[model samples]
Target: MIILAATPIGNLGDASRRLVEALANAEVIAAEDTRTASSLLRALGVDNRPRMIALHEHNEVERAAELVELAREQDVLVLTDAGMPAISDPGFPLVQAAAAADVTVTAIPGPSAVLTALALSGLPTDRFTFEGFVPRKSRVPALSKLAREERTMVFFESPHRIAESLDDMATAFGGDRPAAVCRELTKLHEEIRRGPLAELAEWATGGVRGEIVVVVGGAAAASLDLPTAIAQVLALVEGGARLKEAATEVADATGLGRRELYEGALKERGR
Candidate 1:
């Protein structure tokens, strides 16, 4: 069986009983950083050290097949430095391989920076998307991809790049679009800063530390005339947002209702 476990994002107490048992019993552990995994195990008071292997970005592709092979014979546990494996981490390829090999796969779900940020964001969470992290290079293209994400969107970023990412979001969406920057979630000194993208960008410029999670509100409803709303939606869409997202941005920007703007955009798209 293949077990994908969630490690604590910051607080070690967040580790679950299942995760602890998995660590104790697993024959092999694939970790992004072996030293971090060892430290976590020690902190949890688990004396046994399982055979640990490195499986970060550089070697994930080659390592995945080997890990999958191990899962076919014995229990293999995959973990990252923090949070769940494969969530913007290094476990997806192994999971994919295990699935192809018909291996039984499961998760010992626990702490998540994504969910933690969303819960603290004070934004709409009923419908949300986790984008992991935006691409470092070609940020414009990356922001464009998320332009149409209608659900509240979550992104992981480093402290240094938070300001730049926020600025790009402001440009991709609108300066006034709502967002929240959650730092050091589930840890002491945790902070949640919420407001428009422009304001957040400015606030981040002063300097930031610790882990960063960004939660952005979806585009606003379009209350303007059909043609005007359509134009606004089209502009955002052309600039790299999804159509549904563009409509939301238009609605928010124009103080129009969501349903109306959605319908208008659909009509314009001949949907």
Candidate 2:
């Protein structure tokens, strides 16, 4: 059997009893970081030392079949440095392999940074999307597409890129869009800042540290008329945005169809 266990994101006390038992009894442990896995065992004071193997992104694909085969014979434990495995982390490949081989896979649920940040974000959690990390390139266009997203959006970002990411989000989603920046969650210096995207960008410029989770409130339902949306798109095109890009941006913000907006802009251009 393959056991997917969740480790504490930060607080050690968050470790569940089932995770500890699994760690104590598993024959083979496939960890994202062997050093971290060893440390976790020490932290939990587990006496049974299992054979530990590294199963990180660089090697997970190659090692997945081997690990799944081991699980078929005995319990093989999967873990990450923090949070559940395969959540924007290593472990998915192994899980997929296990499923393909008809190996039983089960999870020992515990702490999660995604859920932690969302709960503390003060945003509408009823509907939310978890986008693990923001891409380094073409981030502007990516965020531009979600400018009109009504469901709250959650994202993980490194400290170095948080400021730039926030700035781009503000530009794409509007400066006044509501957002929260969660830092070092469940740690000593944990902080949660709630404000408009513009304000968060300004704050980030000063400096940021620790693991970061950003939650942005989605765009409200569009109330503008089709003529108004088309006009908006035309204005964007006049300002040098491509017709397609202009239509997409306007349509996102106004809940209009990009095709209709583009056609309307073309008609207006002909006038």
Candidate 3:
């Protein structure tokens, strides 16, 4: 059997009793960082010494088979530095390997950064998606694809990139899109800043620190009428956005035709 465990994201006190007990009795543990695992055991006051193996993004693929084989004999507890193993962390491949080998896999669910951020975001939580982290190089293109997504979105990001990321998001989804920036959640200096994407992006320019989670509200459900949409295109053009680019933006958000928006705006401009 393979046991996937959830570690506290920030507050150590959030560690569940089941997690503590599992660590106390675990014979073998595959941890994202063995040193961090050791530190966790020490912090939790677990006296039992479990054999630990390193399993992270760099080596999880090759290590999965070995860990899966060990699970056939006894339960192998899986852990990451914080949050659940296999989330944005390094446990999915191992779990997949175990599944392919027909080994039983179970989880000791507890704290999750994704869930914590979403619940605290004040956005519609009934439907949502966890997008792990935004790409470093292809950020805009990647986020632009999600511009029309109706489900609330959650993404993890580093402090250094938060400002640029939020700015790019504003450009993709429009500055008025609702969003929340969660920083250092469950920690001493935790903050939840909720507002329009433009406002948040501007505030982030001052600099941000610590673990970050961004929650963006889904696109509005109804598409605007063509005339209204075209007017929006013209308005954007008036604000210095290229006519074609402005039309494309409105078309994407309002489910209209890019050509129609561009032509309509052009005719209106001529009139």
Candidate 4:
């Protein structure tokens, strides 16, 4: 069996009993950072240390196969530096390999930065999407992809790039889109800044510290004027986005007025 364990994001007390037992009993532990895993176990007073092997982005492919081989003989536990494995971490490939090999896979669910941030974001949690981390350089495309995301969006961003990211989000989603910048979540200086994307961009200019989770409210579900809707749809289309996607982006940016954009696009496309 292959067990995917969730580790604490910040507070050590967040670690669950199942996670503790998994850490203690597993024959081998594939950890993103062996040192951190050791520290966590030590903090929890867990003495039985499993053989720890580093399995991060560079080594995950090779290590995953080895772990799967071990799983054929004994239980193997996969963990990340923080949060659940495979979530913007180096566990998806291993999970995929295990699934293909018919290995019994399970998760000892515990602390999750994504869920914690989303819950505290004061945004619509009923329908939300986790985008992990955005590309460091290919930001335009990244923002374009998110422009059409109807559900509330959650993102993990570094302190340094927070301002730039918010600016790009403002450009893609509209400057007035409501959002929250959650900083140092679950820690002593935890703070949540809620406002429009433009305001958040301005706020982040002075610098932000600690781990950052950004949650943006979905576009309002209302209609827009025909000219405004057409202009937005044309901009997206000119940026290489498809008509359907462009329509969605324009609608989300301008509120429920997507039908007008769709119709305008049809006429423009001569369809």
TM-score to true structure, per model: 0.82, 0.86, 0.87, 0.84
Q: For candidate 4, list the clashing residue pairs, or say none.
A: 222-256, 223-257
Candidate 1 matches the true fold with a TM-score of 0.82
TM-score of 4: 0.84
What is candidate 1's lDDT per residue for 74-103, written digit by digit as tens? 888888999989989998888898899888
Q: Encode model 4's per-residue lDDT on 138-208: one tens digit a residue.
A: 56555655665679999999999999999877766777889999987778888999999999999999999
lDDT of each: 0.83, 0.87, 0.89, 0.83
Residues 133-247, model 3: lDDT tens digits: 9888756656766777899999999999999999978876778889999989989999999999999999999999999999999988877567656666765665567999988
TM-score comparison, 1 vs 3, better candidate:
3
Q: Of 2 and 3, which scores higher on lDDT?
A: 3
Write model 2 residue lDDT over 32-102, tens digit each, in one string: 99999999999999987889999999999999999988887888899999999999999999989989999
Please state every model's RMSD to the true fold in angstroms.
Answer: 6.4, 4.4, 4.8, 4.6
Pick out the ten consecutive residues of candidate 1 with the lowest summed lDDT.
220-229
Whole-model lDDT for model 3 versus the true structure? 0.89
Off by over 4 Å in 2: 223-271
